[model samples]
Target: MQAAGPGSNTARPRNAAACVQVRLDDLIAQRIAARSLVLAASRKVSAAQAGVKASRFRGRGVDYVESRGYQPGDDIRSMDWRVTARSGRPHTKVFQEERERSVLLVIDHAASMRFGTRVCFKSVQAARAAALIAWSAIRGGDRVGALGFGSGVTGEVRPAGGPRGVLHCLRALADWDTLARVERESGPAPLSQALERARRLARPGSLVVLLTDGFSSDAAAEAPLARLAGHGDVRLLLMTDALELAAPPRGRYAVALGGVRRWLEFDAAAADTQWTDAFRHRRELLLQQARRLGVAHIAVDTRDDLSRCLAPLGLALATRRSYV
Candidate 1:
């Protein structure tokens, strides 16, 4: 085969997945490296007028940009008295338009996340989404942190600013996926622990984003979600499969028969109607609760484009009146 030139898409090994994990991961990661996951949460809050500078040191008072010589039609109020007195130049100072905010991501990577019938599994999708959001939050000049949650908070990346800090958050989620595990005997970590961390780490105005399949066998996710929602601007981005959203396939999908792949007796409509309705109801219920609490709620299937899905959020965030 002829070697492709620079910028050509490399053909990956085809036999493994419907889409390769790394390809999907990279694709999802690139879509929002600095703004991916936070787009949804950012939408629920306010945004700066333009691309914000990266800063971790949130000023108690808004910082002013350099005072330049007053230009035509410059606002008289912007005139800096100190500069006018010192240099005798007509100088106008511009205040930073965006206030600094922190973002916390709670990610789940249990055995269940590994089950995906589409281009990527929920765990892989969650990782990519978390990576993108962390990047986006940093770009918006917000402190970013993450916790890998399973039965509990298995890993934590202390909140900080910049790409290094974002990477710290990503590695905490990705690297920890392998290193962390919960026992079946122990069950999933009490959701309370994860919520407590979110509460303690996040101040009133910070943004908290949770990426999960909403598939915990635990009694209810509502309590933790409610508490976390109370702490800051919290958004729940439910990552789930099409099957969960769609009614079970009518007849059958291929299933393993004995030791070999063969047609097996299956009931497409066997799922209890009550169960299906309950699942749908819960997804919406979560959204309603988030809304009631002023938290942004968004649902994205694993198969969707990471960028386009976030554009609505960007527009939503663009309307924020800066705190400063």
Candidate 2:
């Protein structure tokens, strides 16, 4: 049996083996290069806040705009007690609508993402995608934060503005990516739990980006995604590998994981059509659920360029649906 397999059209160059490891230096370089790229839909953030586009809804901001007599349906929680007493009538504080939105990245650095036959690992691609989005968010004057999780480790960063926020999120991404491979304690699916955590971190008028390999695309993931999308613009960027979509020709291939090497017996008897179909079905279901719950979904093959794949869809996610 031949040890080498035919490369897919989407696969990277012949020297792709050199790019296997996830490097912080490479991630930093990608961020620096992203400075020249512009995200068009992110520019409509002010319009989204104004309700002109069905994107993010306006929420109470830090800057006070005005105070006025409370209307019948006005939220009681927003009532200004001191102003009400001073005016001898019920009053409410109105805040300026926040146009600068928050960008939240929910990245999964699971062990399954560590295996890649071509180009780079899914984790590396995810990191590259995150860097691109982080820099874009910062350039658009939005706050950036992240929830990085894998195996038994999780890191959370609160939303903040400017280069500082972007840098912090990138550091967390690098740290988690580096540690994911060493973590052997696996429990209840990490993606589902990560999504639940993401739902809690999301604030109204925020953009939440989920980066995963569709490992937990089951019932456990749907509810939390719906909840997250209810309050924020949720975009699911799924990472895939060509090997999962199609089986290699008949062969007994050697594969290694967690320092253990094993041979996968494949022959005419092992028609992988069913296995490939199941993988395709799972991906389809995730995409369908995203549509049903109003979450934007984009699929990226590990062999593809992260920046090019996400630029167009990122714009659509910014304006296509309402985050209310």
Candidate 3:
């Protein structure tokens, strides 16, 4: 799947009445369901050698607190030259370990995401997924932020703690959804651009979650995705629709393309094979990329229950291990 062209019909799925768009109140209500969700590192401890020191679960401290007299075990790299010269004593910068982890959500609202043949549009499902993740993160005492990109427009909410952070992200998601629904003239920005922006906004130890249909992404996304994954955990939530995975029952269907009515024939076996193969190729490309970067990838179909679709994510977040 690629970005929808100009004047393309943004048709709703057969069951479109269920959830065509996301509401702020619905997103906020996810907090209640998120109470049972866990987004923190697991408490289970692995065996370690008696003489070996255990590494920290999170990354090294990056926020400076104050300078103090250097201790024998202090890292030399943290030495404060100015303080050492003024006091005639070696001093080192002290840093506080961040107790709260940062989670950045990169959501895609491209035109391709606006079509679905199930419970909701891909964009709507992505918003719900983002909301659930945000609520779960906040529940775990972590900071939540979001970056929404579509139709050449980008919106960002800086990482913040508590309900304020979740609310800000929810609003951005809602606004992006509305824009994607109304704007059909311009194509969506490439996925690489959004990933690049996320790289700049993310902190070293942040967990970056990308919610996209994987249609806007291509070979161009490789660099920024790898760079983002280099310093933090990157998770891909690939949104898909049932029709995209398989051809409809053998028949001739009338469809609208670029605001023009057209007839499509899917009776031929070769056409079905081609349709399936196209989606398969896209999925395999993304999966291979995630494998190379050692990141986690989860596929969520439009018809899938959000709770069940996100079960793997909970496990992934709870452990340091990567999954595909």
Candidate 4:
């Protein structure tokens, strides 16, 4: 998608402050759009079945039950070596398919996320994105939870099923966004700390979705992210604004920062190259990290439609025909 720059209709609104800030009603309204999302792929089973059905799409089993004599069709990877040696017989591990999968949203409200040269701030887009995912997860019978971290404060909502769970997440998201806006000068909390907290809160086999601009993520975050991925599915949603993806036309421009207006000069030959390269490097670093961990990475631009941006997630979770 083309980056929205100066004078573009898709760029900052006339009343930028109001448009940039997230609103609870806007997040709550995502539930209607979320109805079209399919969070996980599964074959239709008997109506009487309890809990989420085992899906081949998930690839990994959950909740170990016990060991049993190995069957001809048993997956060899699940061989219970310890039990087999003691029993003097081949045995395989058995796992009970997960009842309700928990989906944890780790949202970043870093100071960088507060700036946008598009329809809204990166933080606003992140909140909307998290809300859609939260609503979709609840509709799919999964528990929804969230962790909002930025600056001096971090808010968490433990996983809960149904609408209640999603509401808690939405509230936390909105509250954190406000906090980030008010405490803009305090700088951001380390992304590593938030990831570490997420690792602790997430249950095994849960799905963890991290929404951030990646401004604060660095080498320090790799270990915690890797550990979290080892135990559950991890997806990264990298939020970006038009300005971050591409530089504006070279010229002197008036800008506002913290309610103070100032003039800045931009030159395509030097400043533009450096600006583009910096953003590219940051984006590449995040992409490389995601690849190393074997996780999904989605780039979300401020000007893009939320529904379209999330289509890949829906597809990854289920078959194409599963879209509602």
> How well is each residue in 1-324 modelled by candidate 1, as lDDT tens digits?
011112211122244442323233453345334433344332222324323554433442355667788888777877898988999878977665445677888877655565555555666566666666667776667788887767444677778877778766766665666454333324555445666667777766677778766654233556666776555567677887655565545555465633577653336455546546766764565565566667665676666665555555566556543333
Q: 1-324, model 4: which lDDT tens digit per residue?
A: 122343322222345454578887888888887876668832222222234454533445455778999989777998999999999999998775545778899998777777777677787778888988988988787889999887655888999988987888888787877777677456657788999999999987778999988877778888999998888788999998877877879899887866899987896578888888898886677677889998888989877777777889988766322211
lDDT of 3 by residue, 15-87 (tens): 3343677677777777776765678741223322222444454545455778999888777888999999999
Q: Which candidate ranks first by TM-score, i.e. highest?
A: 3
The C-alpha local distance difference test score for the whole of candidate 2 amounts to: 0.71
How many residue pairs clash in all the candidates, one count each? 8, 0, 0, 0
Tell me the spans in candidate 2 whose CA falls farther than 4 Å from its real position.
Answer: 1-18, 35-37, 40-97, 257-261, 281-285, 318-324
User: What does candidate 2's lDDT look like per residue over 66-156, in tens digits?
Assistant: 7889888777887999999998999987765556677899887766667665566777777778888888878877788999876755889
- Reference-based TM-score of each model: 0.64, 0.74, 0.76, 0.75
RMSD (Å) per prediction = 9.5, 7.6, 8.6, 10.6
Q: Which residues of candidate 1, in runs, are more than 4 Å off?
A: 1-98, 151-153, 180-185, 217-231, 252-275, 281-285, 320-324
In terms of lDDT, the poorest run of 10 residues in model 4 is: 41-50
Each candidate: what lDDT? 0.59, 0.71, 0.77, 0.77
lDDT against true structure, model 1 = 0.59
User: How should the candidates be ordered by TM-score, best one leading?
Assistant: 3, 4, 2, 1
C-alpha lDDT of candidate 4 relative to the true structure: 0.77
